[model samples]
Target chain A: MAINWFKYSSPASFYSLAGKMIPLFAAAAVILLIMGLYIGFFIAPTDFQQGEAYRIIFIHVPAAWMSMFLYVVMACWAGFGLAFNTRLSSMMATAIAPTGAMFTFLALWTGSLWGKPMWGTWWVWDARLTSELILLFLYIGFMSLQAAIDDPRRADKAGAIIALVGVVNIPIIYFSVQWWNTLHQGASVSVNQAPAMASTMLMGMLIMVFASWMYSIAVILKRVRIIILERESHTTWVAELQKDGVA
Target chain B: MKPRHKKLAMIVAGVAALGVASVLVLDAFQSNLVFFFTPTQVAAKEVPIGKSFRIGGLVTEGSVQREDTSTTVYFSVTDTSHTIPVVYTGILPDLFKEGKGVVAQGKMSDRGIFKADEVLAKHDENYMPPEAAEALERAAKAQKASLSE
Candidate 1:
């Protein structure tokens, strides 16, 4: 009966809640990442054809998935901010953009490394790669657009519209493997088929995915706190938090 | 019932609609993106000519012919047993040579020659830029030694 979702919609309340959640997610992320790496590198069988080079998949695929997933989540937050005019939602969207871009770059870098040994090319303008590059550009564009605007509210509205428009590219990136003649391979693991990889490899990838998810949450929470402090600097709670040296 | 909240509702609805539309469009266009085939796959009569695609494999020994600005390179991509011949005209990557893996993007010609528009030299993950020159030097020395023998 005491539950009030709207009460926590205020930046101060959400900041405190996010602060508490960060440590837990960070710890989980570290543990899952270690386990994932151990299984992927040491326990998984070497690919019969690609030999040792195929091990890059454990990192590459998860990073790629996270890149796409984080974009969608950011767009969702941007949408929430635009529709509800929630200060916290826009802050969340802003916080997530850099991390999403980082993962997208990591995925492309690792994929190039993987491709060189297996496909005999360091780069290909295949559907998946091209669309992913576009996704990176979209992230950069959104961030730059927000930074270029002086008014915070206007920035948020502009960013939300861009994010919404760019949302169309996410699905295109995801299904590029299936839609076009790309050098990139098809999905090795899908819900419809048994994974083409060993159980250990599959487990490693899943664990890494979970780790990435937790890591994103922790990073976003930390970033959201900073945004709250900057935006609500004049508020009494912020003043008190600053006095306590917490903000 | 506040004006802000009402505006928020409209934006959320717009995003959802866009998300749905993208999923449908992507699903509809999911088949035309494939552009690469292994030599073995092509050998099995699996590749359709006049369609753009890619071929990946090692540069065949003694198949590189460089003429001033333009170079003619021939390579064979093999998935173990099957090998496809790829012919390319362009500047080969500095690291490109015999037994080195390379991928060329283009379409197969009617003459059964794999005509490439772009050539990419594949290097190992542990590659150092300086190592390419060293590799080329070592290869030349080994070839010279073999001829003298």
Candidate 2:
């Protein structure tokens, strides 16, 4: 069966498709969160050094990964919208920003809590930390720039430019610990090396990562539906849908 | 503005922003990027005397000593080619042990001893932190480069 994927690319069609997907993704997210947290807090062995405090890595590493990954995804969507002038792509970019920012904030806050016990300070100006702080600023800058402009098209173009430029910071953040003498420790899990933690810990962390991924997708879909309504409020189809209580 | 002009404006704006960002990145990398110095750098007089900095490497075997006073501890950090004695007055992190990775932040005395205000052990025993491992590799590379010269 051939499905015309392009049909769903339109905002009106995507709104319904997203509505159908939200509940499934949201359910999976909830289930995975429960399982991941259970395994993370219960099944994973206590560290030989960091003790129970090291358990924070279950949430911290996943949130950190999502923060970086979501930014790249946002930039790609924004770039697509800029190049193709697709309204839905730009709407997706806007929908994703807040979720990405939330994850970034979570990563930093959890990292500070983890640091207080291990590093003896709540924060330090290490290269990794500083670059991550810059990432947070970039997110805020993108949102603020988008909001400041009254025209939606102008806002999308401007926000896209900022998001694209900010992509450079992603590599810097990942490589900061390796490139500089930083107080922040290096990653335990790398492509070329075996993960330093036990198998159970790795499993739990991976599950948590997927949970966060699904959660973001669900939330972004819901937000994008609202954005569609806001942008197309004056259109006949949108008005009909709202009148029929379909929206 | 026409649609064509809008595209041009976006292109120009993106290019300008990227150019500015690249300059900031370069400046940050050059000035604020602190490279880890191995014991070799300390021995070769490469590190500054008065300025506080971090030294990272494996704790030399049989070098950790605890005074009866319990607050002060002594150890030597090494990258195999050289070793620098570190004097720290604090409780050591759980992973601090002989033949393990450590980073000590403090100033160095004229007599070659590191007076550490803080001592940090690596996250695990078997696994060296990537930053510390990379520092060792860099120091070794520099040594090889000098030998070839």
Candidate 3:
């Protein structure tokens, strides 16, 4: 029999469900982080050209990927909220912003560290780099706009509009290396060609990517639960949960 | 505002937002999206004269010359169709080797030479281990030797 898919779409149900999943995801994230870092540092051999400094890719590339990926996910959730007037969808979108921004900041930070010795500068106005910086700003803008609006419903709509608009930057950031003569390099991994990285290096990077994904999911779920509690505080269901000391 | 009227207004606003978003993405792609100009663009005078601009291309083989007493170095950057000689009086990046990609930021001198204040290495996507890199190099040498023989 088909299950009712919308059961958890309600904030009240999703709250406890999210709590149950967060611990599992958080545990997975921690385990994967350790394995990824171990393999990244100990198992992966030194690069022929970049030497030991290239190990930073384990963090940089995965963080960069997640920064973009989370933005898309946020936009999709925000879009669903705008279209269907789903309160849970909007809350999820809002919950995702800080984590996505954090990842974006991490990506830029690690990238500069890697670029300094390899590319000879901490930063440049390259299309890829600038577009990424724009992503960070977009996340900040999304959060700030939401915070500024007193009405949560109106804030969701405004944030959703901006999120949808800023989705265009994702493609520009991904293809900036190809579309322009940017100082940034092209992608190391692509679907059209065999990955250029050594197998062990690729493994470490993939593990780190999964780790980032799990961490983002766990944090977003936790944040969404708190958001539900805050927004539905006046509701009878929330009052019952709070009375029981579970909220 | 009435609930019905507010709902209608929200729908209108959402539609407007979608329109603006589409227009923005289209404009972003269609506009001059170049981050740096190539040697061909520089040769064609597409780059403005005397204004500081970036030029990106492969560092021409066997063209790097270093001054012993100073940090100044001269090299030619080429996109195969055209070339620009660049003079920089600063430290080069680790990846700034002959036949490798580079981007230099500076303006043209009175004699049409590029005097760069900064240089950056443009790396490729390849990220193999040292063993694999050496193996590839050895294979390339063998192929070249066979071609010569």
The Cα RMSD in angstroms, rounded to one decimal, for candidate 3 relative to the true structure is 4.8
Q: Pick the candidate with the highest TM-score.
A: 3
Considering just chain B, what TM-score does every model have?
0.55, 0.62, 0.75
Flag the better candidate by lDDT, 2 or 3: 3
Q: Per-prediction TM-score, please?
A: 0.71, 0.83, 0.88
Write down the worst ten-residue block by lDDT for model 2 chain B: B122-131
lDDT per residue for candidate 3 within A1-247, as digits (tens), equals: 9977789999998998998999999999999999999999999999887889899999999999999999999999999999999999999999999999999999999999999999999998778999999999999999999999999999999999999999999998998888776778888898898888889999999999999999999999999999999999999999999789963
Rank order (by DockQ, best first): 3, 2, 1
Q: Give the TM-score between model 3's chain B and the true chain B.
A: 0.75
TM-score for predicted model 2 compared with the true structure: 0.83
Mark the regions of model 1 whose C-alpha exceeds 4 Å error after superposition: A1-3, B1-112, B115-149
Worst 10 residues of 3 chain A by lDDT: A177-186
- Between candidates 1 and 2, the TM-score winner: 2
Residue-wise C-alpha lDDT for candidate 1, range A94-172, written one tens digit per residue: 9999999999999989988876656656777777888999999999999999999999999999999999999999988
Better of 1 and 3 by DockQ: 3
lDDT of 1 by residue, B7-37 (tens): 9999999999999998986786664334566
* Chain A TM-score compared with the true chain A, each model in order: 0.96, 0.98, 0.98
